[model samples]
Target: MTEHPHVNIKRYRLIRTIVIVWMSVIVFAAFLLNIPRINILEHTARNLYFHVPMWFTMMGAVGVSAWHSVQVLRGGSIISDIRAAQAARVGAWFGVLGLATGIVWARFTWYVGSDIWWNFDPRQTMAALQLLIYGAYFVLRSALDDPEKRARLSAAYNLLAFSTVPFLLYVLPRQMASLHPGADGNPAFSEMTDPVMKLVFYPAVIGFIGLFWLLYTQRVRMSWLAYRIQGESKY
Candidate 1:
């Protein structure tokens, strides 16, 4: 068995403190900072801070997961396997949040009168499909019995999953007619967006991605410990 890897507890704690403080400030600014409201978005505009950041965080997490998966394939270490699995798990949660928030924002802003919760908007549809791809990755991992076989197989599968992200989330959505900002040749969250919103929007993205890192690292540490103590990696 490989020697258990050491996680930098000091670094984790420091980043944990910073993420907490940073996100606290972001939450305050997201609600309190006033700006010229658009006709439809009005107060729901604030959802931009929360909703968009979730997707950003998810994408960041996916990238981290995929990077470690690459390391797993190259070296076949349980360390990279644990990191990849936890990062993808946490990342999927963020994707779910992003989808939920988008649905709520649409209910108020896009579908005000009708009782329509989901209209199958192109971006929304693609986003859901993207989550399912990652979902399969997890299920694929759980079905395998051997750690080395699971690690190698899942790492290859993970690379395939990550490859779908850009096209599903960005490219395909832009090609279809949809209620989302970037549809049919339009840029996502760019045109008609207020400059002041960008101030909070950018930081919110950073904070949430930082938050993903914190959660991902915590899971990595736990998984690493479990592997050390139990002699196998779970999940």
Candidate 2:
């Protein structure tokens, strides 16, 4: 029942306010900002503001999770263990959102003509598989009774799970024939995408990552508080 030193009321309020305003402005620009549209993409191109950021935020969250997992192994602190677990959990939630949004975007843009919501695109398939790997980490933690053992085991699983993210999301899918951008022979933003769009794109990525940190930190605080009160490790 040790207190985590990172939790603070004033700092939390400040970050919450900043994230709220950042997201508000991003939403406004996502709809209002004018950007070039291609033939198939058309208006749905605006989804770049929402869809792309989910994955980027997920990446940021996973990276944070892995860092904390390393701390768990090195520092051997229960709070570090809590942080590592919560971060991975929140990161996985973002991954789900990213996959869901990608499906919807593809449904409209890539599979617009037929009754095909999913055609087993390699990017989609790989991303889903990546999520399943993280899901198993949660299930594995639940099965273990010892707190220290669970922390060490879960941290190892998280490290292995994170290693697959880049290959699944970026490398393996691109090696095959896929409808997603960044694939071989497909149109990429480097040449086709407008510069003005990037003005919004990069900030959207940062804003969503910050939003993930806010949510992650809140959960860490809650899990810590619950652990303190319940005297159990399974928060």
Candidate 3:
């Protein structure tokens, strides 16, 4: 049997403390820093620090999930299976947050004065679909009777789901004219996107990704404990 990752209380506590403190600084800097003003983006530009990084965070989660799925398929590690499920669950949470934030940001900026919240933006539609795909992975896992079969099948499903994320979040959105950047010859970089924002923006991405890791590790521990107590998942 593949050895599961050993838990070190000291290490977990240290990492958790670092994540909390790092994100605290990021939140403070994201709001407090002054940035340049522009015609359409104006103050909403600050959202670049919060909204954009959420997708990045979700991407981080996707990477973790897919990595474990690959490991499970190759090594048949039950621990890898647990890790994949928890990562996907957390990743889906980030997708939900990213979608919700995008809607709010668009409502105030692009859809202001219009009675519309869901405008069927391609990225928006695809993101929701991606989350549903992950949701289906969990459902598929729960339905199977055998643990080994469930792990292998769900890992395969995760890989398939992971394949769609980049197309959904990046490639498809770039094909059409949209409110988001990187469309039409990669010219989204404009004067309004201040370089100063990167100070907070980059750190915010790192912080949120770190936060995802912290939560994921915690969930894995709990899931491992429950698995030890019961022969299978406890509902």
Estimated TM-score for each candidate: 0.95, 0.95, 0.92
Please provide, for model 2 over 1-235, each residue's C-alpha lDDT reduced to its tens digit, 9 standing for 90 to 100: 4445878767777989999999999999988889887899998889988998998888888898999899887856888888888988999999999999999999988999887998998989999999999999999999998888898988988899989888988889878999999787787667777888888888899889889989998999999888878876667
Candidate with best lDDT: 1
TM-score of 3: 0.92
Candidate 1: tens digits of C-alpha lDDT, residues 1-235: 3433557777778999999999999999988999887888898888889998999999999999999999999986788899899999999999999999899899988898897899988989999999999999999999998989999999999999999999999899989998888899655677777899999999999999989988888888788778867887554
lDDT per prediction? 0.90, 0.88, 0.84
Candidate 3: count of backbone clashes, pairs at least 3 residues apart or interchain:
0
lDDT for model 3, please.
Answer: 0.84
Model 2 RMSD in Å is: 2.0
Best-to-worst order by lDDT is 1, 2, 3
Candidate 3 stretches greater than 4 Å from native: 1-5, 189-192, 233-235
After superposing all C-alphas onto the true structure, candidate 3 shows an RMSD in angstroms of 2.9
Q: How far is candidate 1 from the true structure (C-alpha RMSD, Å)?
A: 2.5
How would the candidate models be sorted by TM-score, starting from the highest? 2, 1, 3
